[model samples]
Target: MTLSVKAVAARLEIGRIDWSAYRAPASGGPGLRDLFLGLLDANDESEAVGCSLEYRLEVQSMVYEVALPAVGVILAAYAEDLPLWVEMEFLNVLHNIITGEPHRSELELGNFDLVDRCIERARDGIWVMYSRLSKWNSDFLLDVLEVVDSDRERFAVFKAGFYPE
Candidate 1:
């Protein structure tokens, strides 16, 4: 099910596609932001273990309204891949930020520096997992949406029907 980036770009309806070689920036850019659409790569046939794109958004970026078509598409296709533990972590952090929970307490308790560091790490971890399963190729993504038609299902059926299960 692997596909070239351009094919993905086309399927995702990205009119202008760019395929520059990825390079790590020397240092973090000030006021520069990016919205990445990630694609998950499977460790085997059934389970996803890694991704091609991981992005972060600054707090100020949230102020403006934007339509992230890729995010919606990816989420619809691969929502099942989102692990529960990750969901829990996301919810916890979101609750803390919204209600001024433990995170605020830490800030007021002279752990401001430590809290900031933890917040940054947590942001990285959450975004990595959130973006890890995104991709283009709407057809393949739709194919994945077919619950009974996966390769893993066929393999399992073979193991049950032919070999002892």
Candidate 2:
């Protein structure tokens, strides 16, 4: 089920929410966190702001504070048709959080399903080429995650149950 950016914003109650309360220690004025929230296209659903490789340095420097609401936005966007970039940076952090990465004990992730959806998106040709799956050949980011296979046939066997017909 695909959703619009406005729909996601409303579901998260971003309009009425105060971001300052959720600010992380590394978040400076209008940090990547705010950028992540601000990029939500409440008026346009066809597209929204694109995160870049530059976001990797900023997001990683911020200690993946983007994991909470920012990652939340990333997850919500996954169910949408809108294209996104550099999402691997955030997804990488989420994977670390799930794997109990040090200095990430405070993170509480409840949606392991998105990880599955990421793989599904790759399988379905419904995701941007710059997202996580692309890095399998380019940067090998998936090596850090449980899924390290770049070959589709092999991955199909390795992660058989993830894609349900």
Strongest candidate by TM-score:
2
Clashing pairs in 1: 38-134
For residues 1-165, could you state the per-residue lDDT of candidate 2 as single tens digits?
454535374345434435565434453323544455444442343344453223331234333332344434454544444333334444554444333321242234433343343343333322322243542333333332234234566545433433336
Estimated TM-score per prediction?
0.22, 0.39
Q: CA lDDT of 109 in candidate 1?
A: 52
| lDDT per residue (tens digit) for residues 1-165 in model 1 | 455432253234322223122111222122112212222223232342232122211121221011122222233323334344333322332223222212333335554343233333333333233343233222222222222123566534433443354
What's model 1's lDDT at 43? 28
Choose the strongest candidate by lDDT: 2
Residue-level lDDT for 156 in candidate 1 = 49
Counting clashing residue pairs in each candidate, in order, gives 1, 0
After superposing candidate 2, which stretches have Cα over 4 Å from the reference?
Answer: 1-13, 28-33, 42-66, 86-165
Candidate 1: C-alpha lDDT: 0.29
Candidate 2 lDDT for residue 161: 36
